[model samples]
Target: MKLRPGGFSADRVLRKFLPRSLLGRSLLIVLVPLVLLQGVALLLFYGNHLNELSRRLAGGVAGEAGFMIDEIDRAPDMRSLIIQETDRYFQFTTVFLPNQVLRHLPPPDAPGPVDDDLARALGQEMHRPFNVAWNTAPDFIRINVQMVDGVLSIDVPRKRLYIGTFYLFLIWLIGTAGLLFGISALFLRTQVRGITRLATAAEAFGMGRDPGPIKPEGAIEVRRAATAFNRMQERLRRFLAQRTIMLAGVSHDLRTPLTRLRLSLAMLPEVEPGEMAEMTGDIAEMEQLIATYLSFARGEGSEQAVPTDVAMLLEDVAAAARRAGATIEIGAPEGLTATLRPEAMRRVLTNLIDNARRHAAHVWLSAAIHGRTLRVSIEDDGPGIPTSQRETVFRPFEAASPGGTGLGLAIARDIVGAHGGDIFLFDRPGGGLRVVIELPA
Candidate 1:
């Protein structure tokens, strides 16, 4: 088998950040810039809008103040008329006659302006705009003092525009944050899903299973990775095919000559009985080895999928073993079925049980359902393989007995693997070796 690289797949890399994965991090990177851009846009937009509104406000206030000033100038000698006329056009109007004695100021909540500077400006016949705020409230009064032969002060409440703008900006900031979070989540989810598919496919392929071709979808980088995986899968298939063909040819060629020699040994002289028996045994072992090799080389046939009764198949194999004088037990659920090539599965199970009977005094066969998977186990009552050598024992040419051909386990593994299943040797809980097989249900 080919070695896997040290680093994880792209999908895994993204999964680490968004959903708490890299994709999420990338989305955040893009979203932060967008949020900043929106903030700047809102600032500029509010500034332009407020500047225009401020200009109009200033002009209107000045016009209203100028008219009041003209009326006051006309009635310089009549203080009572000035106050009465001012009241008709202004909501808040107050006039204080020139006094030699200064009076103590009223408390902060008073509606009228109490600024001494504005009072002096009015008396001096000076015209200018000045801001004076109430201590009890956020209200700021803009006083236009006019001293045209007499004291006159007009007050207009300001600060409305700024307060309204504050509330508007607060709403806009909240809305922008929500929008950024939603868009980032959407983009990150899409990227992460594609990466996840690629990772799953890569893992299946690495485990010596033929995972179907990866569809190139999603971002450019993801598509590129899928393309690379497809190429690797194709190369692996070609390599296995070539190896299988080579082994098949060698097995066939070698076995033909062995067959001829075995037949010739039967015709050997009866006087040479000891030599003949020894030669026959050697030839028989060689033939067995050749047969095992060929079986491994010839993988499962290209047969269409069909449903088969697993319970019946196990029963048949068990009966055959019993007839051969092997102590084999069978256990399976009623009406259990599986999608597979029946002949191939039969051959694989037969080889497993046959090998077990040869090594162990008795064998127990059992089947069980595990969620979406079907599990089968063959356990023996003899000494199991060493813990450290379990993996090596499944390899070809690594047999416990001198005359045993290790190809039996290898062939069984290949057949099961082709069906998207696996065979493993484990130490039985009680004792001896246990061969467990897992197949998709």
Candidate 2:
């Protein structure tokens, strides 16, 4: 499929924020909604349930303090008696100051929900103005109520205004979500692993390498895809085998009659030289056409892939071309090795170089490594192919040049494609054709 230029750039931008792999994307699909649900639940619990509970707890503490203040005011002579009784029963300590008055102080910088609730509750219950200090000490809350001539100081323990159940609810919510996400990740990874194996097998088969038996696994859809791939692989192999056999038989049968005709022409006495030359030339062209067809049909034979030094192979091709009176320049790095069918790859390179030599006086060959791919370019100084005809020239029997069988580029492309590589044609920098071959390292 062809993509618009802007489509590719937009996809890249989207990928920057999205996960790149199937497993990660699947995990995101599962976890995002779960996190949002948990967030909403926590918000509701804090807004309604936790807030109401804090207010009630604060009100209870304020009620106890108000009762103590009223008892001390009604019987000022028994202030010590009221203090002793309240301390014994309610866990509060109250002191009566006769001469000094207490001033109101500012609230703390970091006040808790309990502090706000307590302030409101105390404001409604007490008739006189008061000051509430939450940070007077770490373990207690202090409330000072102004009296006509003195002040009433009350100290209450911090635990009286807090609900222990709030913390328990939070722990349960977070711990359960973590456990659920972990389980989901484990399940997702197992399913994704099957797809990974299937992709690897498909790639190896495309490169003409043996991919051992593929067993179906994962979800039903993934299994279906694997089954389809296996069937396609078998059908392609059978078709190629049948074609090769048919071509071999045809080539053998045609050559026998052509050989007898050549012998008959040679034995004829006083044959017209011009007519005889023409007949022989036609016979020679027929033979050359048959040979080219046979070569393309056989697909360079069934050769196993092995590690080969690409630089040395190029050097040998250049040396051979030079001996044939072709000026060829090769630029490649040392010790560049790749797994390949050496004979087939050599044929591909030789065909490209020969085609270049036929049109240009000087040919240039260069290689470079880009990421995980090795790129090799062959350039010539001849007239470059027009963009419209570049793809058409790769078809069998479709030649760009006169008197050519037109199978050179087609055969080269087939061989390169079998090795999971691609060949592209472009205009040379100065004025000719440039062919680029890209192979995975």
Candidate 3:
């Protein structure tokens, strides 16, 4: 189990070498088997069929050469006649080179099992000094055998040792394998495309960006998977819709009584001025509380994603903070755009800026595009939350200050998360809170 501690495991090594994409792995799946089948077929043909066929052909030629030699040795005067007779019968080009001593020659360096088989057959048939030139000519093999008086040269046609059908068979195997591989790759790519689209849609949906129903295509299983993803998207949208309608009704019903209470208080002619002021203030606060709670529950409603000028949006929030009697400094470039729900992002910016304004002497707002992310930061001179409490402050109802609903940071984080972004809390360099929201661009 621990052959080499922390080195490499068989599974890990295999995974590292394997193709990562569905299409690559799919093609490999088809390819590996096709190659193996072809290899086995080639081996069977070469080992059993072609190898034996070459040896048998080589044997026949060697036998004919031996017969001609024997005839010449028996009747030395009929040597010329024997060469002519053998050439006519065996379709060989034959000649006798007289008084030419065949000397020591280099070893055979020819390739293929055919030449080796032929050489072995020749050695067995005729026991004499001999040399075979396999590659001197394309259509012929030159065999030189040393005779008592001279050397016998026989040119055997190369066709005797080779068959044309083997080459054709090889071409057919390769061509068919390539054809099948191409067809499989074509169909596999279409199926992989369906899965890829489905995966993309899922990612966008999870990021709170809407990707409408993807087209169902490809094989039956892939199509079924695509259909399921589309159905899941529909179900989620329907559920959110139903919850929104129900929450809207609840908001209306709760506000109706408060509206009546405000109207009644306004008409009370005998009420003391100071007491009326307090009652009106309390009523307004209650209404505000109701709206905040409803907003937290609704979580920015089903707003479709669109490209918005986030720099302009930050300026608007800063202006609102100024109107609310807070001094604010702003720095953001023009045309800093990102895809997000404008209204939902508005609530996030408003909540963060307002939170900074409440306790800080001054507020700073800035927006910048960082690579593919839109980074918006709100810094203030207010006392920063403890590092330990920074994460806790985002939890619903976990108010950081007295009388604070604690839903502001929670709602802000929810909205940012829905946009496939994040909110981070950090200590400002001097002495304050630094709130940064990063959204995908």
Candidate 4:
């Protein structure tokens, strides 16, 4: 993502994390923090809940054990009540009494060892106890105990509280991170939409499309960039206008004197014969040079554009070439319409055809549709331009031929550019040169 001139973009910050696109980067920016926040919140919530649960569990176990002891002391036959209350009140329940003297009143199973720690604490002899597993892993074992002297003992499951708390934190972390990342990506795309538009407009402008002016609406930074680009385009327009005015003045001043000289030389001809003819030829070449400049000076804005039959225009150019003893083929059926400045476009095509006629034995002029564009090509069977000279031929004052004025192709290029079109000169396949002009349909 590119930062605007006057202000920074959020997309720039987003790039640090995502490092790919405005959307991806911005999402990561928002997502990382939100995920961290969610993780912290989950940790706090789960920690508080687990802490309370652990406290309640410890209290309940101690309270139930005390109650059972009191019940046993209250009535000798209340042992069944103790067992029933234990089963009802606690998550894990077991009963024990001294040695084999205590047994399951309902039935008989092998006697189990009482909790050694609980029995030692209660000052009671060994008794059978049944194991119970609760918060601990399935393999975790625990036992409850009752001494013959009515002292009760209990061994709570170990490691279950710690492991449960850790697992809950892990689950909360994963879930919160996933949710936060998804939400962040959705929101960030909305924020980056404006930036994407700005980037696309810049690219179009760079590619020589008159994408018009961007609507300066969005975040402050993006609006400022659009406004600046508008200003720059306005300045560029003024510069081109100024250049055209200067060139027009120069061409007029230079051509008026050249015109007078040509008329004077025509009057003086046949007197000095060969000397006069050589001087007249040089003067004629100079006049042609001046005319070429004038043509270039007359830029695209000087011509009015309208929907014109390109096929007809091409036929006219080819007919003019044929009349000059140039072998030119005109392609396309008549009546193909396109938006163009017919007079200017005609001049461009004529200049290209004239160049080809001068250089080669045969020239081909053709028009065809290329997707949404209208393509006109002039190909010639001549020694083609070198790769290095292809681009140089388009520059003003760089002649492609020894006797040629270079401004013909240059003027054509400028005119095509002004109409939001392009022209390219290249070597045709199997030899010769090809000039292609592309204009929007």
Identify the leading candidate in terms of lDDT: 3
Q: List where candidate 1 sits over 4 angstroms from the true fold.
A: 1-194, 203-212, 266-282, 296-320, 334-348, 371-374, 386-392, 410-430, 438-441
For residue 152, give model 1's deviation from the true position in Å: 31
Candidate 4 regions off by >4 Å? 1-24, 40-215, 218-224, 258-287, 297-350, 364-378, 412-427, 435-441
Task: Give one digit per residue, the lDDT tens place, for model 1 in 52-140.
Answer: 55545445444555566666667666756766776566543545435222223343342222233234333343354233334423454
Q: Could you arrange the candidates by TM-score from highest to lowest?
A: 2, 3, 1, 4
| Per-residue lDDT of 213 in model 3 | 94
Using TM-score as the measure, the top candidate is 2
Tens digits of per-residue lDDT for model 4 on 247-276? 878878887888788788779735677877
Clash tally, candidates in order? 6, 0, 0, 1
| TM-scores, all models, native as reference | 0.55, 0.83, 0.81, 0.54
Candidate 1 structure, TM-score to reference: 0.55
Tens-place lDDT digits, model 2, residues 110-214: 334787888889998888888887788888888898877788888888788877777887898899889999999999998898899899998987787767668
Task: Please report, as a residue range, the 10-residue window in candidate 4 with the lowest summed lDDT.
Answer: 106-115
Q: How many clashing pairs does model 3 include?
A: 0
lDDT of model 2 at position 262: 92
User: What's the CA RMSD for each of the models?
Assistant: 10.7, 4.4, 3.9, 11.0
- In model 2, the worst 10-residue window by lDDT is 103-112
